[model samples]
Target: MAGDASPAVAALSEAELLSRIFPRLAVDATHSAATLLGPGDDAAIISAPDARTVISIDTQVQDQDFRLAWPNGYRSTGFDVGWKAAAQNLSDINAMGARATSMVVSLTLPPDTPVTWVEDLADGLTAGIRGLGADGCSVAGGDLGRGREISVTVAVLGTLDGGPPVLRSGAQPGDVLALAGTAGQAAAGLALLESGVPMEQLDDGLRNLTERQRRPVPPLQAGPAARKAGATAMLDVSDGLLRDGRRMALASHVAMDLDPDRLGPLAAGVEPAARLLGRNAMEWVLSGGEDHGLLATFPPDIQLPPGFTAIGSIQALGIDEGPRVTIAGRAADTGGWDHFAD
Candidate 1:
């Protein structure tokens, strides 16, 4: 119903559809190194040089995680969905301080979905893998099925490169908390879209913000870099800063004190959009999610790797404070993206 109704998936058999899409995916340079055996086989073979694999999976469903038509929705392209599907799982691997080496995607579509859309989605998947400078990673294989709505599930495989996986529970008191990539911009973009502002009238900055919300590009390299730099604890910021920070704090049995002053620079990028909407930029910075930036902690003496900014410090949990996160010396709310939150 969304695209041109002609040349739909129903026009061809499953084998016919695979013939059209598989070649586009198999030709990507990124897949060649990781995939020993690709499509047309019973299963794909991927290399795991580190003797251990870090795996993560994520799913995106139509109208829930995305929408084809809505002022507040992404009105997403196939590439956008493909890129985002890969990105979310890649970020998870990165959070563990590993390099993503391969992925398997599962897609479900309505009978009337366009074949071109599926091909474009494959292109987006390859683009996302190579986009992270992960030239060796590939889409191993996937399953396709008819469903009520379009849905994508991506599972990624990563390698630690002989390094220990960084766990959220390893942070210690005096560890310097750092962040890589962005915060708030994606949320601001969502707000702008919901505001019903005409996309054509938006400035370049606002356009970029909305694009981020639709398809976030997390710093995939930063994860392994943080691990190599001796990060004690880490995670990707899929949820809001406050929410994810609290998760790490609780896991580590510590408390975090985030300085508002230090977060100002990070919040600056969203200020224009925030002002235009008459909203507080800082709130977005604090509570906005889906940026997929890496949040990590390191020994106070360790120099942070490139792309990371020191934002806070870890502390011993006070008896009353419990395992919590604080901003500007006050306990912060753990409000963020909750799938079933009322």
Candidate 2:
């Protein structure tokens, strides 16, 4: 039988833990809603009288989403873990065109975890919320449990604020396709860091890629802005561009066509990163995930908001036809991220 031989764990009081751990982490202040019986409570409750709430939750597994120990043996900071959890949850809220209000996190960690790690993770979570303009959201409540592998689950709540929630099914034929926020930067960043290529050796474009992967800059405001601009349909580019565009097409019963020239600028940005990795930049731009750009369709003559650029168009198609996503008039074999792909 295996025996448990570990250091004599100093069981610090929660207050001691907070004091020792908090300074190393980011701070996110919450408005009154997140304060109704906060940190010391068994649970947290917030006011939600907006008559409608948009909720989203996500779970990340250690090696699946990210490695605890990278090729350089760089262990991710507690802040990194917390930041990612909050960002993923908040991204979903942004996708629904809502303002994030509050959040709760549940954590499972090894018994050997340091108290500082927990505190820093909390700080990161708050920082992520703040970064997305979730002024009213806080860490609120969470669970601490033991496990062999690290896993985090976060639940977020948001208010629509009298704005209509945009759906994936409202696009119409001849509607113009537009994108808000840049694309392919995150994928390029991951490639540069993973390949042991130093940042100094790369050009400014490639360096931007490194920044994209380390900290995602999601367009939280873009979703609501699109809805307000009378967008026919919308979705955040959580998956790759092709996959997400195809989703809108299927839901709206339209065929989607993207002009490669319109995406040329973004394509140019990923080239250096691709050349360094011996891959095609267009592949990364078309299929990379985690960029979180907003993809929307609108009437051709409608005026778009700042941060948005036209990319393509929606077309009427046969009812029995599969949703078509074409790139520069050609059918693309790989549309985007698929969990089961070999």
| Candidate that scores best on TM-score | 1
> Would you list the C-alpha lDDT of every candidate in the order shown?
0.86, 0.75
Candidate 2 regions off by >4 Å?
1-37, 72-74, 198-207
CA lDDT for candidate 1 = 0.86
Global fold similarity of model 2 (TM-score): 0.87
Clashing pairs in 1: none
Clashing pairs in 2: none
Best by lDDT: 1
Task: Find the 10 residues in a row with the least total lDDT in model 2.
Answer: 1-10
Cα deviation at 41, candidate 2, in Å, is 3.7
lDDT of 2 by residue, 1-342 (tens): 013232211465545555554353324344435445555577777656677778888886677666665553346667777777877777778777777777777777665666656766777776777776677776666665668777889988888788888888998999999998878887777777677665567677776676576557778788777877888898888778998888898898888999999999988988887887898888888988778788998898899977789999898887677778888768875556666685
Evaluate model 1: give its TM-score: 0.96
